[model samples]
Target: MKRVGSFLGDWWRLVIPYFRSEEWPIAIALLIGAIALTFAGVGLEVLFNDWNRRFYDSIQNKNETVFWREIIFFSWLAALYIMVFVARAIVSPYLRLRWRRWLTSHYLAHWLDDRGYYRIELTRAVDNVDQRIAEDLNQLGQYTMTLLLGLLGAVATLISFLFILWELSGPLSLASIGIDITVPGYMAWVCLIYAVVGSYLANLVGRRLIPLNFMRQRFEANFRFSLVRVRENAEGIALYHGEKREADSLNARFIDVFNNGFRVLMTQAQLAFYQSGYAQLAIIFPYVVTAPRFFAGVITFGVMTQTASAFGQVQTALSFFIDNYTSLAELRAVMDRLKGLQIATDEKPPTAIEVMPQPGRSGVATEDLTLSLPGGQALLENLDLPLEKGQSVLVRGASGTGKSTLFRALAGIWPFGRGRVRVPEGARVLFLPQKPYIPIGTLRDAVRYPDENSRASDADIAAALQATGLGHLTDRLDEVAHWSNVLSGGEQQRLAAARAIVFKPDWLFMDEATASLDDAAEATVYNALKKQLPGTTMVSIGHRPTLRKWHDRQLELKRAPGEVGTLVEVPA
Candidate 1:
């Protein structure tokens, strides 16, 4: 009872969001329609059961007219049943798609909001959030519908067919042992007991598999992520001769995959041990109990067939828990992953400073700004910084000294900080990371990402690329490639700069966005920034001395013994 209650709790927690989403009306309507159709199909099942009695009786009687009449009756019933089945298939997948769409967007919204995805990545809180969103979310949505429909159909079958089973089978007797066992609805009771015992045994053998499968997914995702990391940094790895270590790292990740998979195989073998033999025994158990009466002329051939049919129905209903146990385990694994993500999304770092409102001020700004790491180590502390309209500056700090962290804080991505950041009304801010993100698409589409490609004209894109010294790319603007893989690092970095030139935001914060380029290339990117949007407030974090010349002033994070991150303003 306790376990059942807990399962219900988890199910509700997983399922409630869909019914409350913007697509609720369509989602719920199709859901209810699918369920209704499922029950309708099951109702035809009961009709078929009744038809079995009448049609077979006519056959045994050798009555041609009644047999033909029964045939016509069944034809109509079969047609209706076919209609229900067709409706179920069509509408169920429709609901599945809608649910998947809503769920993916919903999870993405929470996961990506305020760089929640980045936090999840940095903290390693959700080991397979990418897999969960892309793969598991779709499976969860689809399989959840199938499982719910199955449960409903099973329940409806059990209620309607239990009567037929009880009426068909009676008490059992073992006269050889001088024993008599009187059980009303004896076959139904036997199947119920058999299924309950079998389900318990299956769970006992398979319970460990739930955790094993969960770990297996995590391991596979880790291995895949490692491979992707290698691909992303293939040049650096080759230049440094790090192939041996990379191979060792990949081998270790595969080792994790191997061990987790071995455990799953062992547990599945244990399950097959019981379910296989149990299934083999099921083929004959009904006949052994009913054959004696049939041979003794107590029941006709039609009666024998009816008895077997009823036994199958009773057994199927009783074994619902047994059959669905594997799916339940898989569901548990998905639930745990999704539940972990939910916990992470709901969590807010306590160190984040509240945004202070100034009495006479009108735009967005921060006061007494302080930034810290997730471990509570301060990156920027007790600093008074202000930005006014048409003002631009550069922020410089040592590598990994939280210059990127400050950028994240400013963009409200990293929550582990103390700062009140304020910006003016109707101000649009864009943050450019070190590597430009080139989505897989036409060059035109990649340039205008986070906005539809149709929303931007190709001529305008060509002009921006030309201005950024990427005129060669302008001719291939409509061509598609894995731009990250196809374009050189310098070009990809410039592509981001070109994006800035095209978007023309009110403010742009570049975090080593041109680190891969040469001094000349870096100078060209900045010149493009200045030429395209001279009034756009620009703040950059870079190490090159030449970069300091691009900005009017610099704030460098100075370090000393016993001090990790202390920002010291650099004189212009």
Candidate 2:
């Protein structure tokens, strides 16, 4: 019960916002409409119960006029029922979509804000974030609509039918069954007991489904993620001829999915068996209970028929939870995943590194800065470096010696560090990693990314591409393709350099941004930047000795065994 309460608390946090959001008026109105339709449906059921008694009485009496009149009455009732059902079907899903749109946009903002996407990955707090955002949100919307409407309908049906069952049930005596007992409204009490027992048994049979569904979602997402990974790296796998290895890994992931799916199927089968029997038995149990009174002439055939119908309605209303156990389990799983994503995205990282703007500063500066690996091993310690405007510096260090990490710190992304790194106020800074992220879009968009609506003239963009040795792509700016997969590594780096020229930031940090190009091509790219953007300050990480002459000064990171590296000046 405590666990259920906790689950409901989380559910409220997810659901209440939609009804109180800017879209609240429409959402609340639609919800009220849907709810009114639900009760109208219950009203139709009660009307049918009355019609059942009259129709059956006419049959027993063989009265053609009464039978035909009742049939016409039912036609109108059925029409109204159909209308209510159809309206609810349409309005309920519309409500779900509205809630879904708001929820998807809300989560997208949080997941993308403050680099939450990157931090989530670095912390590894949640798995399959893409699946959580895409599939889980969709499931949440669908399941919430189903469960909420089902519950409301159940409550309305119970209220409507319970009174009818109580009024028609009369009384029962157990003297003939070797017991001396009398009960009032015995049929209503029977339904309450039956539903209570059935619900308890259903909960027992299906409790394991909660965790099973959770694991199934994870397993399916894992398998899907593996397939996407393989597709993204198809070129590298083909180059290595690793199809057999890839196939084995993929098959193993599928095995996890299959095994968990089998378990779920088994549990569902158990639940289905119990629920089916319970329902089939309900159909006959009400008739059996009322037949004795009818045979004793204690009631008319109409009374017996009405009593049975009301009993069925009451029982059906009470069995709502039993019928929706699997859906409830599935909803629980989705809620857990979404809650986990929310917590992870909202959490602040523990590291104490701080980056802020210093007024009157012209370039980047680090004071008493220390950096570490994600696992807390020191990478660089107490390294103070001052970079002035219009100066270019090349940073060199051995592989795994924190060169790229230092660049990350300077870019204000590496959070696993301490102390302060300050940059000039209102300065435009850009970081170019070894592999530039080329979003799947047109060449013009890729070259002018982070500025989707760049106003730079085509001629200016074309010149930048030509100067970076990518003149062939100048005319294809509007052609859309997966540019990252289409371009060679050297061409990609040159494209990034072209992007840098278009951006024209005040400070540019490149972490081996030109490693893919040949020395001559790299020199051409750097020299072009020197002649065109002479005021831009540059910090670069590279191992090539040919890169030394482009920078006016150099900082090399040096580390001894089991100690953090320190940055020192070196000759250019």
Candidate 3:
């Protein structure tokens, strides 16, 4: 019972927010319409049950006139049933889609806000968030609507039919057995018992499906992610001749999917077999129990048939869980995954380094800044670094001395330490990494990115491209393609340099941004930065001796064998 309560609480948290959102009016209207249709469909089933009795009795009594009239009545009844269900089908799915849209937008905001995606990735706190957002949200919306409507319809059917079955059931006497006992509404009691037992057995057969479905989604996402990795890094793999290794790794991932899928299939088969036999037995069980009364001539053929129809309706309504146990299991798994993502994103990082805006300040500076790995090993300690406006400083360190991490801490992304980083209010800062991210889009957008709203005209963009020795791509500004895959490494670095030229940030931090370019090309890019944006404060991390001439001062990070590194000012 506690587990059930927790499951429902999680489901409510995931489902209720959309209805209370700005789209509530339309969402509520569609939901109410679908529910109204559900009740109308159940009401129509009652009418059909009555018609079944009239038609069958007409045939039993050889009354053609009454039989023909009842047949026409069924036609009208069937038409109304079709219209109600059709409207329900339309409204329900439309509501699901709208709910899904709202949820996708909401989750995307939380995941991207405050660089939550980066933190989640850096800490390995959650896995396959893309799948959770893309696939799990869709399933959550779909199954929530399906199960809610199904359960409501079941309740209505059960209420409407149970009374009819009871009234038609009458009392049964067992004096011939010498006990002289009587059972009231015997058929209703029998149906209630039968449905209860069937549901219990169905649950027993399919309870493992919940955990299996959860793992199944994870395995499938892992396999698909592996394929995407291979595609994205095709050049690296091909150059290293790692196709065979990739193939074996891919097969290994798929084996998890294959084995789990086989177990799901076998479990579903067991459930299907049980449900089919139960349903077939239900068909005859109703008439078999009530037939004795019909044979005894205590009721008309119409009453016997009506009693059987009512029995079927009540039994089906009670068997709702039995029929949908698998869907229920899948829904449980979806809720668990989405709830996990929600919790992970909502959590605040502990001991996060603080970055504050100091208005009226001229450039970036750090106070008592410390940096560490995710595993809590200190890299840099008690460092106070300050730079004034228009000052170009180069940061130099041996490999793994936290040069790049210091950049991240300055960028306010590395959260594994505590410190205060101060920057001027409303300062535009850009960090160009070793391998710049080239979004899959047109060349213009890729160059203007991290700020797609840049108003840099085509002429301005083209000039930046030419300045960075990428004049060949100027004409293809509007052509959309996967820029990362299309551009070579040196070309990509040059393109990133062009982006820096276009963006013209007040403070530009480049971490080996020119490492891939040739000496002449790198010189051209650095000279362009100096001439184009002379007021920009530059902090670069690089090992090349040629890089020293472009900066006014230098800071080197040095550490002993087992001590944390410290930054020291050095002559350029």
TM-score to native of every candidate shown: 0.88, 0.97, 0.97
Model 3 misplaced stretches (Cα beyond 4 Å) = 176-178, 560-563
Tens-digit per-residue lDDT, 317-385, candidate 3? 999999999998999999989888888888766777888998798878898887888888888887788
Clashes of each: 8, 0, 0
lDDT of 2 by residue, 62-135 (tens): 99999999999999999999999899989999998888889899999999897788888887889999899888
Q: What is candidate 1's CA lDDT for residue 79?
A: 91
Q: Write the per-residue lDDT of candidate 1 for residues 157-223, one digit (tens) a residue.
A: 8887777778777666655577665567777777777777888888888788778878877898999
RMSD of model 3 against the true structure: 1.4
lDDT of each: 0.80, 0.89, 0.91
In model 3, the Cα lDDT at residue 285 comes to 92
In angstroms, how far off is 251's CA in candidate 3? Answer: 0.7
